[model samples]
Target: MRFFNTEGPVRPTDHYSLPPLERWDLNEILTFIEQKKYFLLHAPRQTGKTTCLLALMDHLNRTGLYRACYANIEGAQAAREDVERGMAIICSVLARSAQHYLQDSRLNNWVRADGALVPAGDRLFQLLEYWAAADARPAVLLLDEVDALVGDTLISLLRQVRAGYTQRPNGFPQTLILCGVRDLRDYRIHGSSERDPITGGSAFNIKAKSLRLDDFSAAEVRTLLLRHTAETGQVFTSEALDRVWDLTQGQPWLVNTLAYRACFELPEGRDRTRPITLALIDQAKEALILERVTHLDQLAYKLREPRVRHVIEPMLAGTALGDVPDDDIQYLLDLGLLRQGNGGLTIANPIYREVLPRTLAFTPQASLPQIYPTWLNADGSLNPTALLEAFLAFWRQHGEPLLRSAPYHEIAPHLVLMAFLHRVVNGGGTLEREYAIGMGRMDLCLRYGAVTLGMELKVWRDGAPDPLTEGLIQLDGYLAGLGLSSGWLVIFDRRADQPPMAERTASSTTVSPHGRSIELVRA
Candidate 1:
């Protein structure tokens, strides 16, 4: 039976899939190809880019309007700065892909050309000229993972393609598509002769436009999930389906992975009579994250990059991001970590919302000592008073040391607290985080069965004033959203003159204008 595909390009006959062409602007793409334009098709990895390009190639070929072939040249990424070797591998891959897709072997014949030699830089250009001349139909070349080729090799490839642009459809490809995680404008190539990085547009100069393959829409997400129901008579509850969209926000890989896990991996999920529930969906979501699956693992690893850190640090800390570069923002977008939101940037999806904090807090959580689950009552209910006391005790003893060991300097205290809470709340509850730029404080809502305890985290920097007033106001608003009467407001004084943590840590209770009692904690 067909299943959800996460490993590679989705095959409609083998995997449940939405029509690939529906994900983007097909008319604009066709217009570019008809005009013989060299362009870029880019989006985050595993967002079904290769699948759509393959669909496009098949569409063009069936219409007999162009001879199209899709080639993944990422295999040459291993060649790195070796332009000659990289070009040779790319040419070979292109030839094989042409033969496999279009039954064309002329590229192989022209590779050697009776022992006649072309310059290393001109090899790709010469092969393209020979291939185009051999076919009466205009050839459309789709190069996947074009960004994987780095340094001088990437430069040489782009330069070679541009050099033969004027002769396209006769001596070169009629239309060329460079497909990768980043748009051509964002390419920062460090070629051997360059003292500094150069933009990809400078290297190619022939690109006409860049098109991004968008994630599936809400309706599309439902359609993909309903495939399991249609095939096996196993139903997904309305809430379960809604939760899928809510968690993934239509990221294709994530949507498919969750459905695949629920339907095929879990024994209860496989029983046709059992309807998938929202709880089950939530379980699958966390399992996917905790397993450190390939897609999520790759994304989390990007956090170590200095460029990625700058934007994410302020985001986690709820402070303003000052003087961040435009290129770094675009790079994060290209990496699929951040998406353009209503007015600014946001973590792309709810799954990412959970993934980022847990990833940052992973180490501190693991290093935690064997402390009792002191907050759990005999009836398994959460004792809020005890939980807060435990947190205070833990903070007094280990918080400072953990903060010193944190990877992100700007958000160290926040991470340590989150790590402590996550380790304490495992197996019986869920932790949800809400923070954003200029919010001045991070709000966390911990749901343990019937208990929903909210906490507000604020940092008082060296020159900043005490945050009690602003934090209480924000806490009241946050409580209103949660339909709660009270919560905790934590202010970490970072001023240089502050006494040692041992001397200053304290907690008290305060009343808001709305008559909600807030437990105020100062550390």
Candidate 2:
């Protein structure tokens, strides 16, 4: 009766899961622990860091090599700049964890018994020193969500750990592992009085190395899905399995959530006799996105951050990343919002690719003016010509104002257009997007009933020439990929000298170099 686990830590008995240790380099980790090196284990939220840490603690304890305990210090986040409160919370949690995990009760009442006398900065150091002295086996501490501590609280924690680094195995924890969504190097801690932010490296210079936990590989994704089949005798078609990998790119929580929805939540998928098919997988993905599930919703919330917008806006518009800082890009990569592909920085996966733009356009989509479905025929088929006309009229009257609602200014036009199209395909159709670094254009494919429409969005900047010829060539390639002879190419005029939106917005018919008919819209 094991199910795919999407929440909290994975328990093998209750959930179908890959062996946690197998996801990491066991030898490297053991080497760090044996050497008593303080280090970091980081990955995006919900990538199974807690599950892995718990398993590692059990492994170390069972081997009789160490007395290990895993404690989540995220609860200390609420203390913010209050160093004393944060330290007390952290110490008490660690004490409870030690008692539970190793039957070590020496530090159980240490927080209430002695913490008030010691300085907030020295409390953690004192607790660890006493705990290590009480055990013959070296104490291995795995602290999860270490980054959740903020400001002065975070600074005190790191400085205390650094202060006690010299006393190892005998006086302090042998191997201290900090786990969080971002590597410690990414921590920019601002203290209450400091003029400049404190880098994590300066506070905790003893870190030996940073290890990143990665998403599951394609093979691992397959193995997890097949486990459900083996247990329930409800098969997943080959295409459905591949679709899952394509959408999630092996993000652990996403894979589990999608599979859980497909197998348990969706009524059609619950039937033991019915094989999970490609269509069902797509339905599950759409449902997950529309439901605005917590995982994806948190990701969408990140788009509002200036750093995130810096990297994402240009990527969305398919423009060169001009003067973007290395740390900003690294931040997105660490958040698992972007990945380093052979093609350079790309959104992590297909599911994210769709989610980012739709999330960006959500407000504009809602603000869209009321307009009848002039683009649809009596039989509910899309009329490409009519759709273009409707869009042109919409742009003339409301597009300029709607642009104000776009998430990022650089890509406002793209967002506004997507908003209109999202309204077009609201309930019955699908909108697929293909944009990436160096692509120089965002390609979109809209499928409504029996009709498919292709589009390419380009911007005509201040110093650039009209993108008409270039867009035609690109749209021709895009249409060919979709196996269609016709599509639309939209060039938003962003040049400083351009006329007003209402006056300049217009469309014309043209033929691509490949002789495919193209509906060219210039706005």
Candidate 3:
């Protein structure tokens, strides 16, 4: 039976999937190919660009309108700056693809006969020229993972494509599509010599348009889940379906992974008589995050990149963007880590918002010093007073030293605190975070059994006024949202003039303007 596919391209016969061509503007794509245009198709990793391109290739070839072929040049990335080796691999892959997809063997013969005669920079151009000439039908070439080529190799490929721009239909492929994780214009090609860095737009100036493949829509997400019901007679409750949409925001791989885990991997869910519920979906999400599966793991690995950090750090700390470059913001958007909407820029979806901070706190969480479970009562529920006391004691002894271990210095205190809280929630509770650009504070809610603890974290930096009043107000609002009467407002004073951790850290009881009880913690 077909199942949700998390790895590689989705085949309809083997996987539950949407129609590929329906994901984009098919009429516009057809027009571009008919006009012999060179363009780009880009999206974040695992968003189905390759799947769509392959389907498009099939559609074109089936029409008998063009000799279409799809080739992935990712195998050449290992050559790095070695243009000759990279180009050779690309040409060979293309030749094999032509044979497999079009029943055309002339490209293979041409590569054997003329491969060495052409210069490294002109090899791709020559191969396409020969293939287009050998066939009466115009050629449509789909080059997947085009950005995987590095440095001078990438430069050479783009320039070669640009070099062959004018000779289409007969002398070169009538339509060439470059597909990658980012738009070609975002590439910064650096050579091995003293020459300056080159922009991809300068190298591939002939590109007529660039299109991005979006995540599935909410309706599509529902349709996919219902397909399983149609086939297996096991249904997803309305709330379960809504939960899936909320968590995944229609990210293709995430949707498939969650559904697969809930319906197939979990023993309780394996019974075809059982219906999927929201709790099961939440359990799957928690398991997915804990496993750090390949997609989420790769995303976590990208947090260390300077450009990514430049945009992410401030967002995590709930501070103003503070002069971040537009390119850095755009890069995050292109990566599908952030989205812009009427609510403004936020992490793309709820799952990503949860993942980023947890990923950052991972090291600190693993290395936390020994502390007794004083917060756990004999009955197994959490004790708020004991939890606070335990945190204060932990902070007094090891907070300063542990702060140094945080991944981002600007948000060190936040990560260190989260590391401690993660220990409290460990196996039986949930820690939820809500922070965003211009929010000026990070709000957290810890739910353990029947008890809920709301919190608001504010950083009191130099040149900024005391955040106590603002934080209390924010905490009051947050507590109301959680239907709680009291919570904690933590203010981390980061001013250079402040005393050391042990001397300055303290807590006191207060009241919000709305009469809710507040535990004011200043550290």
Candidate 4:
């Protein structure tokens, strides 16, 4: 029976997937290949580059237009230090791929010929040339994981492909597509001396065009999932589809992962006629994030990279970083970590934004508990007076130590303040957190039953007077939107000379146009 595939490439018999050819923008690619144009195909790992290449190869072979072969050079990465070993492995993989796809033993034999097999400096290029020559139809080569090789090995492979570009259609392969997670232009190689800088020598410049495989569109995602419905008669409700999109932004692996878990891993009796709903998708998202699956973990690790931070930091602050280079943004987009929105760049999906902060600070100390009071009067309302009094006392005693011990020292004061509130509110309610690098502030929404409390947290910098007036104005606006009577503004006076838990209270609630007054609290 067909099922959702989260592992490797999906085979037709194993899963009902989008026709692989239809998954990519193949017309543009084929047009370039038809013109004998060498190009690059790149996308983050597990976005189906390999599957797309295999499908394209089958199409080319079946149409009798070209003798196509797809080979992965990832194994060559292990042999990088020894060029001869790497070359041999490359030739072997290529020969194996060609034999499997074309069933042509001669192609392998031609590659293994005396001078052809071991052409010293450019042995791999000679092998490719000989195979292209041996084929009746012009050969199309898909070099998967082209970026895996390092140093001279990577440089040699690219230069050889460039050197043989002119002989295409007659001597060299008619079309060569280098496939990898990153574009060739981003490749930085160091020479044998280890000190020699080879920035722009004979690199791979033969690329006529570059194509990136993108995540499924919203419509495409629906279609892919509905294929399962069509086959198994189990439908995903409209809300479920929307939730999937909201959580994954149609990221291929994430979409597939959620569907796989829901359909296959959810409790047996629960897979009845009841359609999968938004709630189920939410559950799957929570599970996946908590589980820290490989793909998500790897993506989270990339947030530490300076290039990723360049884009993410501003977005978190609810602002756009000005004029990020197209290539850099595209790299992140290709990785399925960020998406372009009408407003600007945002984390690709809500789940990612939710997971990012926790993932970034992956330590037991970072997992501060959320604090909320329960067992209030039966109306689901919190005892505001008691809660406030208790928090004040707690803050007075341990607040300084907590602030000093916060893991993010740069933002320690603000984090500790939030942590304190969270610890107090954990048992009975929810706290929504929003903070971005360079945002200079954190927004927290505490929900205790029907009582909604909004707080804007800012750390006092350079002994500046508390931003109480500004905080009151912001809190007033927030309360007005929520149609609430009052709210609290908590500011951390990081530079204050006063002892911890020292509180200054001001209680003239400013009334908004909507008649809601915001009460200000400064600690």
As for model 2, its CA RMSD to the true structure in angstroms is 1.6
* Displacement of the residue 398 alpha carbon in candidate 2, Å: 0.7
Per-candidate count of clashing residue pairs (backbone under 3 Å)? 0, 0, 0, 9
TM-score of each: 0.96, 0.97, 0.97, 0.82
What is the C-alpha lDDT profile of model 2 across 1-523, one tens digit per residue?
A: 9999989999999999999999999999999999999999999999999999999999998999899999999999999988888998999899889889878777877877887689998999999998888878899999999988879899889888888889998999999999999876645686653335755436777899999999999999999999999999999999999999999999999999999999999999999899999999999998998888999999999998888888898888888899998878888998999999877889999999999999999999989888899999888899988999999999998988999998789889999999999889987999999998778999999999999999999999987788888888888889999999998999999888778899999999889999998888999
Q: Which of the predicted structures, 1 or 4, would earn the higher TM-score when compared with the native?
A: 1
Note the residue pairs that clash in candidate 2.
Answer: none
lDDT preference between candidates 1 and 2, better one? 2
As for lDDT, the candidate ahead, 2 or 4, is 2
lDDT tens digits, residue span 219-244, model 3: 99999988899999999999999999
Write the residue-wise lDDT of candidate 4 on 1-523 in tens digits.
7888898887989976888788777788888888998888888888888999999988998998799999998999987767777787888889888889889777578656654546646887788788888867999999999877877677777777778888888899999988998755545566653335576543776778777788888998899889888877888989898888877777788899898888777773147576777767766776787789998888888876766766765554333467766756877877777766775566777677766655544432344443345325567577766666656655565565666564445555555555555455544565566655345556667777677777666556565666766566666666666666766666656564655455542223455444555554555
Off by over 4 Å in 1: 112-116, 191-195, 198-201
- What tens digits encode model 1's per-residue C-alpha lDDT throughout 383-458? 9999989988888888778887778878788888889888767867888899888888889999988999999999
